[model samples]
Target: MGLLDGILGQVAGNPEIANLAERIGLSPEQVTAAIAALGAAHTQPGDTVAGAADSTGLSPDVLQQILTHLGGEGALGRLGALLGGAEGADGSGGLGSMLGGLFGKA
Candidate 1:
């Protein structure tokens, strides 16, 4: 569950994330499980997402695709969840290309 590990690593280190379980109103164990889910979740452009999948050992291409579709708000959370969230406010992955196709900055 490398993806999950990365997400957890990020969450654990979050200055704003006091207690994920507490904030989410989930038990510590449940929080762990959720983190695990994030790890297992997969994204598209298989090549780009493969390295993360290999590390996280997750298996949910569909979810990843959905997350990609969701863009900044959704995909971003997932990306931050995976990339430790220190990468700024920008969400993970390229939503522009995935959204309306490559057409330069709107």
Candidate 2:
């Protein structure tokens, strides 16, 4: 599989994709494409759903459904983590560090 496909698989497994595809009335492949498009659009400034819809040709409403299914705004952060954008220079997993900080760990 390609890098993006690998990331997608890690982010949303087959069962999740199948459920989302069925709910959105889109094929699993299309759902995957939409997820990728949303991830790409999220890197930019402004409305993610609109940008994803423009790129993927899947209406904003559908993209919104996908976004909500993927866990709303927090999904983008999770995607970024999967894409390696969440690692610190010290190699401490970003989310792990944040949670550790919350618990007063050194």
Candidate 3:
């Protein structure tokens, strides 16, 4: 699917994400902008979640909400826990999954 389509899908599937944006006072266009910004990024292989937040137009808090809703409470949490379950890996972190620095200087 195209980028825009994928984004709409993300928001549609997750009401929390939609509510978070609404509560944050983000306009539909701003939400679109945020998602588009994220989509255009290409995070490095070792980049931390914070680092990706900096590159995207959206803030870390906003990003967290998006991520939380993207995979739903159950899936991403389980995914995060499963990934964090590895020995020596620090717990209490986000999903190890990377979506690339989609908003690469665009």
Model 3 alpha-carbon miss at residue 97, Å: 21
Report, for every candidate in turn, its global Cα lDDT versus the true structure: 0.40, 0.71, 0.44
TM of each candidate vs. truth: 0.29, 0.71, 0.38
lDDT per residue (tens digit) for residues 17-93 in model 1 = 33444554545454343334443443433443454445545443633442343342354344444354333466644
- Winning model by TM-score: 2
Mark the 10 consecutive residues where model 3 has the least summed lDDT: 97-106
Which one wins on lDDT? Answer: 2
Q: By TM-score, is 2 or 3 better?
A: 2
Per-residue CA lDDT of model 2 for 1-106, tens digit only, reads 3656665654354556777789879988888888889988898988999999999999999999888876776766666664566566786565454323323353
Give the alpha carbon lDDT tens digit for every residue of 1-106 in model 3. Answer: 3534544454434444456568777765555445444433322344333554776656777765555444433343333333334324563222222121111111
| Candidates in descending lDDT order | 2, 3, 1
Candidate RMSDs in Å, in order, are 10.5, 6.5, 11.9
The RMSD (Cα, Å) of candidate 2 is: 6.5
Model 2 bad stretches (over 4 Å): 9-13, 85-106
**43 in model 3: Cα distance from truth in Å?**
5.6
